[model samples]
Target: MSMAPAVDAGLALLILGLGLWIIAARSNFAAVVGFMTYGLMLALVWVRLTAVDVAMTEAALGAGLTGVLLLGAAARLPAEAPGGGPGAGLRVLVAVLCVGVAAALAGVVLSLPEPAPSLAPLVAENLPPTGVKNPVTGVLLAHRAIDTLLETVVLIPALIGVWALAADRAWGARPGALTPRPSSSSLTLLAQVLPPFGILVGVHLVWAGADEPGGKFQGAAVLAAMWVLVVMAGLADLPKVTNRLMRYTLVLGPLVFVAIGLAGIWTAGAFLALPAGYAKPLIVLIEVVLTLSVALMLGLLLAGPPKERA
Candidate 1:
């Protein structure tokens, strides 16, 4: 076997081992670290498979952002108490069962057929008409546009579920009691610098997305990060649930997308079909609105509740 395959195999094994270690280990902190390592290693595996887009996503969303979220969650959790109840025999049996299942899965994956002729050619042929260079994006926005629209709809309900779970808590609760007050000197500096830089990057990502790997989702995430930073730093307060503007912004993306999709059906006999000669501009408009909606949703998720203005 070539060295490349050998390296890939090593990395895959390392990721699996770390995942198993995380499951078997008693320490929550150690488990979180292991999960982070698994995410990074998984990104490497994606790179090895020549999926740069997936690799970037795994690196950003899985490793970097998820690790930060997990660490923050870990910090809020209570320390492990003495005297856990799982006996040795139970642990052993569970481990054995898990190993058996994993082995079965690996065998199944190994037995899968190799790639045959794919739909890439068909997609590539249609790319020019769609005005998207990337087949993945074209498939997402054009061929499977309904799926994309529905997924955005699902996001709102998911956010609602999270909000319902935390409804009783203060909307502006800091992570812990030791959460530093927002007016601290260093925090003020962060507040001032981070939001603009984040917005700049977010806009760039959205624009570059036309020809690059970035898109509405990634750009929205960056914009959301900026909103989160500002909210956490006390530079901007969360709006009340009754706030009309906040509610509108939160629902704007899906509403706009749906309206446009219906309009497409009227104009072109197909849902989400951009009018002839205006496809690129329409797609960009839809994406911009989607980015704004995603940013608002993310900001609301982080902010929890409306804070009372002092």
Candidate 2:
């Protein structure tokens, strides 16, 4: 008998177990660990569903970056205070609400049409004008360019929100360091050894995105993770909030995208519509700059608001 079903069943069980463990875990750190593992398993599930792009994104942002963020938060929080706990009634109510939400979601999913709605055929028919082989890329960059642009632009405000957490007096200062203690020799060594390879992989993901199951976001997440690793190991320090170059880097992606879109109105009669024969180059340029901006934004957000005077 084929073992694929057995393997899939095992994966499903493992994911469900992890979810329960995360909810039941007493320590914040333990819960964060379980959440990370759960994210990884979900990534695997995406892979099994043949959604490689989503799988990469899940592994990169959902598992890797989010896990770090939660870990940092857990580290910063104080230990549980004696006699300061949620009441059993509150817990029971929360559990009921969660179950209701889950059941509703399951019902909606199960009620989806037998064939399901899809724009894939339309995307394939229209993709050639966008000059990209990957249908997902064509859909994101060409067919839905405005949405992608808005998504990138939204990160600026999100980063600003993170910065708003700081005291006014700390406005221009550096963010809090990622870790409190001195780095161990092993961590330092891994920091040195891993970033080079990680960077290459990140770049490859962006470069290959035009025709493959990769994209700027996945690349940016990997790049951000490497930078975080370096900072966590004491090999690098977070930049000052008021650094001119850093500010420029943060805005570069969105600025370029908007500029390209404006030029398109004159050339193609529509904003964000790439002119014929130049689509691929313009798309590649946007991807590269967006990767840089996103990587920096994610890293800075994880670094938290400015905590020390410059």
Candidate 3:
């Protein structure tokens, strides 16, 4: 058998095993661990499917940051005594039901038309004017910019909701830290060693995403992870939700995107359309600002709702 098929087969089995393990886990923490592993494996599956952008997103948010967030939640919760859940018969019934659902999903996938329809050719024809070599970038920034713009804007209300969870007295206080204890020696060492390299990688992702399989979301997630590490290692503190500077950072991307969209009406006779020759510069400008804004917003979101320390 060729190596590619073997890899795919093994990946599929590992994913299946982890999914079952998560469902069967006796402890929430163990289930979270299994889910995280499943997420990573799914990212690799995305790569095998030739969707590296989706892969980056899955590994970064779905696996890495989410694992960190849930692990923190688990640590804070009272320990379960571990004896009492659905009995074996119910478990068996549930398993059968899950198998049925999975079978239905598989049926849906297999029933899809062969040689799936794609807009790749249409995107290619319009891509040169966008100045980005990445087709995904072109689609996001040029063809369907409003969708991407709104996606960024949506984070604002999410952060607001998180902040609203704070007690009225905690309004100006920082969010709860994900990792509040003094760092272990090894963790500190990793924190110090990783950020320089991590920052470099994040910037490269944003910069190259304009021409390759990376973009603001993936790059920002990497940057956010680095900031998260710094906080977890006790090297820095997150700003208060009410801080003027922090709020500005949160909205900067959406603000700039909206500005560009309005400018487009004058420059190109349509919202978010690039001028005849300035496509590259405008896209780069948007990417750079949005990267910073996105990194900040995601970092804060992972830190949870703001509240005063007792």
Model 2 worst lDDT run, 10 consecutive residues:
174-183
Clash pairs, model 3 backbone: none
| Rank order (by lDDT, best first) | 2, 3, 1
Q: Write the per-residue lDDT of candidate 3 for residues 152-194, one digit (tens) a residue.
A: 8888888787777888888888888664566589888888999
Between the candidate structures 1 and 3, which one is better when assessed by TM-score? Answer: 3
lDDT winner among the candidates? 2
Give me the overall lDDT of model 3: 0.88
Per-model TM-score versus the true fold: 0.81, 0.92, 0.89
The residue ranges of model 1 lying beyond 4 angstroms of the native Cα positions read 1-7, 72-77, 80-105, 166-184, 305-310
Model 1 C-alpha lDDT per residue in residues 179-296, reported as the tens digit of each score = 3264777877887888888899889877777667777777777887776666667676556665678778889999998988999988878888877767777777878898899877
Deviation of model 3 at 16, angstroms: 1.4
Write the residue-wise lDDT of candidate 2 on 1-310 in tens digits. Answer: 5998998999999998999999989899999999999999999999988989999999888998889889988887877946777889998999999999999999989999989888888888888988878787888898899999999899899889989999988888888847534759999899999999999999999989999999999999989989988988888878899999999999999999999999999999999999999998999999999999999998898888888643
Q: What is the lDDT of residue 34 in candidate 3?
A: 91
Candidate 3 lDDT for residue 227: 93
